[model samples]
Target: MVRPGQIYKISANILKSRLQMTIRASISCNGVEIADVTQPVKEGVPEILNMRV
Candidate 1:
């Protein structure tokens, strides 16, 4: 779904393994590609913060 004032490309891929599995995702919004992000998989935490909020 496309929202007003928002642009993005969403995709997904899956990897199969014996002891481990991995899912890959790629997202690009408004010509800015978002890749290579590191985060804790168990929580919803913002990597960057805004001081105004």
Candidate 2:
């Protein structure tokens, strides 16, 4: 369980990091770019957060 202020701080940090990464993005392909890409990080996998498992 997380304390009141602790969770807020952790969540705030996560949002800040996510926002930073969003500002900086790169293409994976060298010669050609992929078409109809749903998600930037995970293409096939719908749940990118589940990659840890």
TM-score of each: 0.25, 0.17
- Native-referenced Cα lDDT, model 2: 0.24
Candidate 1 residue-wise lDDT, 1-53, digit = tens: 43445444333322333433333344456787544332222123223311110
Worst 10 residues of 2 by lDDT: 4-13
Error of 1 at 29 (Å): 3.3
Candidate 1 Cα outliers beyond 4 Å, as residue runs: 4-16, 34-53
Q: Model 2 off-target regions past 4 Å?
A: 1-20, 23-30, 35-53
For each of the candidates, the C-alpha root-mean-square deviation to the true structure, in angstroms, is 9.3, 15.9
**lDDT of candidate 2 at residue 29, scale 0 to 100:** 46
Q: Ten residues in a row with the worst lDDT in model 1?
A: 44-53
> What alpha-carbon RMSD in Å does predicted model 1 have with respect to the real structure?
9.3
